[model samples]
Target: MPTRRYDNSPGLGSLYARTVKATLRKAEYEPDTDGLTLELPRALVDQDHLTAYREVTGFSAGPALPVTYPHILAFPLHLDLMSDPSFPYKPMGIVHLANTITQLRPIPMHAELSIKVHSGPERPHPKGTVFDILSDVSVDGEVVWNDTTTLLSRSPGTPSAHADLLPDPCLEARAFWDLRANLGRRYAAASGDRNPIHLFKLSAQAFGFPRQIAHGMWAKAAALASIQRARALPDAFTVRVDFRKPLLLPSRVQFAHTITDAATDFAIYNDDTTITHLIGQLVAR
Candidate 1:
């Protein structure tokens, strides 16, 4: 796959900013979900680009697509909504904080689908501000998958962008699972995120990490699975999350999470651990 043409520098235009703010809480903008189903298209499941799709997330030996690929269907629609000219949002400056999803059943490769997107208000941040989005995908009137993502838009501040930096330790510790041969292939086919940084040891080492790192979505999937199993909610509708740090490859580390209320949750490393990578929550639908 080609390098993603991600040039989000300089931010979005003022028109886009104002437009995005205006539609802060658009109610149920439903899309046609007539043939919606958790099925992957033959083109997606049989993609020739990612050789690594056979192993890590397990795409070849099943009747389902890995959990990560739903974003392919959902995100394009998200982009469509954001660029509606009537809708509001500038994708350039927003930081993706976290992604949470629930799977009603395995997504079968080569099925038709549809989606619905919900937008919400800006969440007050400790330093900056954040926004939330909800998207639900269904098949034949039965809901199949859903995701809630948080994007943060920060305002310029603190020392006026020219102050001396304080010595802040890397607050999070993270470890990556080695997936170069097996896991990498599986994740690539499943997620459509075939960035080479996640493919091999040498490829990752060039980027300054020790070895090939796991896909952020893989860890995300694991986190969601953890929450679902613990809460025993096979059909959770929403989730809250914070990405603190990136996890490196070929390793094992501790995982911990705590919930204080309906809308608040924290996930991080154990008190004595240093390799923490992510923090977030699982919310009810």
Candidate 2:
């Protein structure tokens, strides 16, 4: 990918200064390649949590959440930095233009895990700024999964109602319905997120699943659909979701939406009713 360069526009100059000051004061500032360790809670894999994970990641009849769930741990770090009083922007105001997850291993169920997060400097774009975050999720001191997430914060000169508002509840939405296998294939084709655990029985079983699973984004898309259908709105708005847990395959995952004046909240649950996944807020453009 090409490196994003600073625009040097008046607005960008102002936003950059504010971002630098806020980031400098409390930034994780940990050196690149230096690892910070965090003890992962057993509660994160508790039976109840597992059930929710299975439902949300579409692993009900299959394996545990794809190795991707741990990637979400880094999101809190972004929240911490964005929420700092000195920070120039509110995360809710930013648009999640794109997200990609690359998995390294199969995260075992019922295992204690550790995580370390590293974030790079702001990479500027013509319309916004992009930052890169890398996280390593380990178990018993051995690296089990490494993930990267990118977030884009649009320039204030860009029109947005959420500029200063804090994140609020998200509206609910459903996913487009298709054959299960077709849904899996479509997402893989579009996302280049071809995890075998979501493709074939033998492939999934090799990864500790009883059956094939669904991509995490599919559930997110479903949630977005549910919200759009309920409100009868167009599909051009912005969305930002935190993948709290996974949803399993071949199960009915119920989606609920709650919209406040400022934002929308969407949650997905398994048939057992555990919160398999949660989307913090979806902003209407």
Candidate 3:
């Protein structure tokens, strides 16, 4: 398929403005297309941005780029595709239900890289409609990293009888993180994912949230960070996460993991409650 190429990155403010209008207009659902492909210019990693990301997520500053960094680079394009008028659903309240990242190999710092993003067709889900956004990163024509992010748009519909039942909690927390109120802003600053709902209370209220919420990806990264601190991760592996609920800003959360020869099962829960915020596993590749 012919790809759209952008010389300059899309502006976040304009994209958010467009999303607001799109939400209020209540655009009708359109049939999903083959999906948009976006190719970004080759660029070197910015040291400052890398530093901030490392500090916030606790990823080590090293020769290899953190596995999740490419998602940050492709984020603007993801927003562009979702905010387009032809998109079937409003950008607001779209839930990031799951994400799976496959690190083919370690990506070196300062390497000039190319990124391509594909927003896939929407599929039926128990609660609503779901879709995949796939991203691929390459260096010198060789694909180095990729990710598949699944999102959901809730609508009036019958629940799927085939939905997988939730797994029973299997482990207790090994660590806890007391996330600060500015977590959303701090993450947004480093990741370039300044989604309004994550930035501040007013912006979140506009989107029907009581207060600001932490980014799902940030929470995932934080979980991985904690896991890495406990044990070294396999170089080639898959980290998958299902975001059950939003982690309210400035809240304390618990993390636990059950490790096996092939994979590790992990979960994040509300510090004072039994509610699961996210559940995921890391599988050896």
Which 10 consecutive positions of candidate 1 have the poorest summed lDDT?
A: 1-10
If scored against the real structure, what TM-score would every candidate get?
0.51, 0.42, 0.92
**RMSD of candidate 1 to the true fold?**
11.3
Q: What's the lDDT of the predicted structure labeled candidate 3?
A: 0.83
Those runs of model 3 whose alpha carbons end farther than 4 Å from true positions after fitting are 26-33, 164-169
Measured over all alpha carbons after superposition, the RMSD of each candidate to the real structure, in angstroms, is: 11.3, 18.5, 2.0
In candidate 1, stretches whose alpha carbon ends up further than 4 angstroms from where it belongs are: 1-54, 58-68, 82-89, 104-111, 157-176, 179-190, 193-215, 222-240, 248-272, 280-285
In candidate 1, how many Å is residue 199 off? Answer: 9.2
Q: What is the lDDT of residue 259 in candidate 2?
A: 70
- Residues 224-245 of candidate 3 have per-residue lDDT tens digits of 8878888888888988888888
Better of 1 and 3 by TM-score: 3
> Against the unseen true structure, what C-alpha lDDT does each candidate score?
0.50, 0.50, 0.83
Q: Cα deviation in Å at residue 188, candidate 2?
A: 24
Model 2, range 1-285, lDDT digits (tens) per residue? 111122221132343355445645644333332333223332244555445444544443224344334544344444443544533444443444334344344566666666555555666655676665555666777765565566666763344322222243443334423335445655554433455676776877786768776766566655654564576432224455555554455556666677766667666655554454554455544
